[model samples]
Target: MNSYMKHGFAVAALSAACNAAFAADDITVIKIGSAAPTTGAIANLGKENENGARLAVEDVNRRGLVINGKKIKLELDAVDDQADPRQGTQVAQRLVDDGVVAVVGHLNSGVSIAASRIYHDAQILQISPDSTNPKFTQQGFNTTYRLVATDAQQSPVLAHYALETLKAKKVAIVDDSTAYGQGLADQFSSAVKSGGATVVAREATNDKTIDFKGVITKIKGQSPDVIFYGGMDATAGPFIKQVAQLGLNAKVLGGDGTCSDEVIALAGPAVDRLVCSIAGLPLSRMKAGPAFEKEYQQRFGMPVQIYAPYAYDAVMVIVDAMKKSGSTDHAKILAAASATDYQGLTGQIQFDDKGDVRSPRLTLYGYKDGKKTLLTTMTP
Candidate 1:
């Protein structure tokens, strides 16, 4: 009796050890990094991008991803860049140093452009969900990918819409002087002049400024049919409010930075005269939009401002690439990303040779009755 009991106990101990070893070998953790301004003036947009990445991580984990015969658990490493280039580069290095397999952040084009060099040096895949300055993808860095349309495409579409649809014969322009703001304004100004519209005035400001009285007063003298502002919702909202205060009747135009629900809160009644362009189709138009919006609201307890869906897609794109390659190695992910053909909430996402979305579309929007209303969708 004693010998038999001892043998049974020995066999059970061996089985338990083997089971623990198998369980340990069957799971792998994949960390993905994201950076955006979650505390600054445009933090709403940054938060949107972050939430997207977070949602993607959660969603991927829920589905129980299996890669190379091992169960994969995705982790999101998120940081705030304050939409500043210096902080962006810092966050980029932090993510790289932390050994993230991929990154999905830096909402501002300026931040994305600055931080991209760090990601490139580390050979990590960096996908920006909203940065649209055009220069971010032109730097010959195969590690960089953007899920949205660039300003090179958006500004022209917006300018032509202003001329043809809005009939803005005389346009005034203001830029916040940041990389994203200035670059987009430059593109829009060029397109406006080319479209046979008159640019009566041009002005510049900083990202942190709250008052735009000087520029508004100067622009008002010109009696512009439309006043184009190239900046985020923070400055753009207050500037639109000032325009209304001073009795300027010109329609305010901007890029995706100002095409958000935050503008309604920032401008109040002045939002009625605001028109902006986003880098993709309106959320309501996407086949997956309703479901995503529902899930996002349930998880985050707030509505998406902008770029959340794109950010989610960016993370998913990286995960999809990792799956295709059956590895989380940066180089393999980058190669797989170069050939991405996934249809996401933002539509088909396929990168061009320069790492920009292929045939990216721009969506024009206007605020009416304190809500964002889609005006039209255009491509260039």
Candidate 2:
């Protein structure tokens, strides 16, 4: 009895160990890259973008994602580009070398544009949640996609608001000289002129320029009714603060980058006179935005920044493409992604021919009582 019992127990333990090993090997892991500037002035926003992708990976794994009858686990390969174009290209090559099936990042438009060539050459799908410049998608690369409206669509809406709602006959334009900022400013300038408003002054500043006294001084003399700033909140906040300190009595308008809670923190009470626009609907207005916000805050212990929801949706879209294509092949996923019609946290996402979201919505925001308040939502 002792010999038989010992043999039976050994065989059972061996079988159990083999089964466990097989089960472990049965689950396939897929790596997706998330690139953003996590160490720079706009790091808060970049971290938010990466966190969104990380959360999506976590959620998909939690739900037991299976593709092609294989249990799948997703890995997020997050990188920091520091919002630099050269760094972005380097990160792109690194992501390609790392064998990521797709990427979601390079929040700056210039960075996205610079990195798209690498992704394109490697046949990796790249989805940018925050890059608003039109050139990112118009490069004739099938690998590029985005989740929000473009600057071409966003700038005009801001311009229309300035001309019709704010009744500004004279507008001043300032840009941070990056692709996103300068491109947005150029578009806004054209729209403003077309809307019958005079562009009193146009100025340029680098993204890191904190001292806007000289630019603001020049704009102040113009006595414009509204000053449009095309840049991120890091500079927008200080620019507005200096505008007030200089006793400029004009309203400050900005694009999606300037439409953030960070601006309120950076500009203080000067944010009261600032108006901004987001490329997508406000969190309260999104179909699943409230739930996404709650989950994001719980997971990260921080409130949702502007692009978190979009980044989350971008990852989901990539996974959705994998499922629909029934394969993880980059080409198959890219084909499927081009035809995505999923309802995401932001809204229904379907890419147009240029790999841009179709029929995107824009929201105008103003600060009330030290918080961002939605002024209006428009479709352009």
Candidate 3:
């Protein structure tokens, strides 16, 4: 053949080879579900959690991830649970039905507890970014996992802080009557009592109750050195505001739910007296936290509230499992996730047999100068 003919033949053969390789490396979509209270009192928290998951999905896609010899495209199926248990279960069913290989949400411990059974039955992996109540992992579901420490871990820290750090003799406790609220309150009450502190008053309220005057009136009579609230920022904010209004001198304490930027905004000047516990190191303390926060703010146009890093890490954890398993099969993903020990932006995430993060850390934070100030870090 002539030189031109030979060159043309070589180019045609190379084109054929490239086409075959491209056809063999087909792309597939893998769906991940995230459910949270996207519309109710604590929507800011839920939105922040979802944003973390979104950022993970975006990053994974941008990186051109491949699994089992096939190019993978991650898709997030984020749902609004309204922060309601009933709604959470419904969302769980929907996510399972939608064939998500894994899930990365249900920010409330109550929601996570209620929704976990569904994910378990579906054999899909469910990793919670927040959800600190101990009952979440105690139910013994293989599919259940959490990125943060449980209420069993946080309540004692808060209780000890109130008793030792704050030097409180008399304490009053209030719960929002939900699974999470009641659970944490019970743990705190027990912890304080065990520490030789007095729980002078115990009150109950619903998550939606805006008025705390009646409860405060009852609690004021006790004259507690600190009042611990077992609820989210929406309720805790108003409760703290009322604490200031009622001329109550006691400090306010709460778990991860009340630990957010929204709390300071809601409580206004009253936030000075507010102290809260979050499940891991503060954003400033995490090695990758500062950079993650900067990138997250640039991507989402908002600062990280709480659990965004956890949620982001949860997504990465699930994807890491998928990569290890080399398949998107639910069972394989669950097995891989159960054995995950990924080092995420949050921390080293290694799950114990109960699907809980081992050696989880907690941080005590208070608002100072309109920003969250880290008081201490503890492991309980």
Candidate 4:
């Protein structure tokens, strides 16, 4: 059979297995699907997301959650989608086939966009830590939940900072050609346009291409005052390196994807003007930031990445919803999540009309001298 047919069958079979089947048994095995890039290109990010989720699972089980007179033990079934959408869809189907109660994964919005439908049909709740596409929850999928702020919330904030704060007019845009990358690029472009700044050029590159000399050359030709990259740090780092070698005189404006230590390490000194907007982690500027950052460092023995806190919060949000619902039944979980109003390590986690987080704080960062410094923040 063709791949599409196979995908359809898997989704169908999965829906039949898990959709609202255990509506009566609220204390059934809480199977939680966790899909991320455990292998292949983006393994580093995948592992961090996994770590956050695992930590929460441990905490939940330790608390000995009592539901329906039975102790609830969360069973986290992890899978490696390798940051690929096809693999993510398959993993979602497998989890539904296994009758998982919920899920917390698909680190990229690209993967989540493809997998959410399968979970929706199966009535299996999914709480994503990193997927930021507004469409994921806006598709009328009650099962879809996310802890990260969407590009719709961060893009315009970044654009306003670029023109008002950074004082840049001519800006260029680039994306990785994936769902998350292109969608973020579009939002950022719209924001830039609204800010009265012109995007001199827009370009796209696939996940495979490592060399960005061609794109850099084109960017240099336009000589934009600033450049906005709506993709992750994986390729953005190397792209910055090449852009530096060619001496492109433009301030770098990137989204949350570039707000990682990995990007700083790869881009090095060339990232002096690196400006980015991210779903504000409470570990940096908040009164709780220093404590959480310190604890995370002590436990993990390393600086926390962008998504760790978000992932940790995603797990907490799901667990909180389960507690509030007083049951792990799929429908109960949905109702509980819809009424969530809790403060997370990321901030006060609340959903809006589209089921996306509302009033999320977007923080901007800049690389000045030899350190990444906070530039500003605002609501989007």
Runs off by more than 4 Å, candidate 1:
1-25
Instruction: Show the lowest summed lDDT stretch of 10 residues, model 3.
Output: 21-30
Q: Is candidate 2 or candidate 4 better by TM-score?
A: 2
Error of 1 at 153 (Å): 0.9
- Tell me the spans in candidate 2 whose CA falls farther than 4 Å from its real position: 1-16
Per-residue CA lDDT of model 3 for 240-299, tens digit only, reads: 999999999999999989988888888889998999999888888899899999999999
- The best candidate by lDDT is 2
**Candidate 2 at 4: error in angstroms?**
9.0
Residue 275 alpha-carbon offset, candidate 3, angstroms: 0.8
lDDT of 1: 0.90
lDDT at 46 for candidate 2?
95
lDDT-superior candidate, 1 or 4: 1
Give stretches of model 4 more than 4 Å off.
Answer: 1-29, 286-288
> All models: lDDT?
0.90, 0.93, 0.91, 0.80
Per-prediction tally of clashes: 0, 0, 1, 0
> lDDT tens digits, residues 207-306, model 1?
9887999889999999999999999999888999999999998899999998988888888899999989999877788898989999999999998777
| Model 4, residue pairs in steric clash | none
The digit string of per-residue lDDT tens for model 2 on 52-78 reads 999999999999999999999999999
Worst 10 residues of 1 by lDDT: 371-380
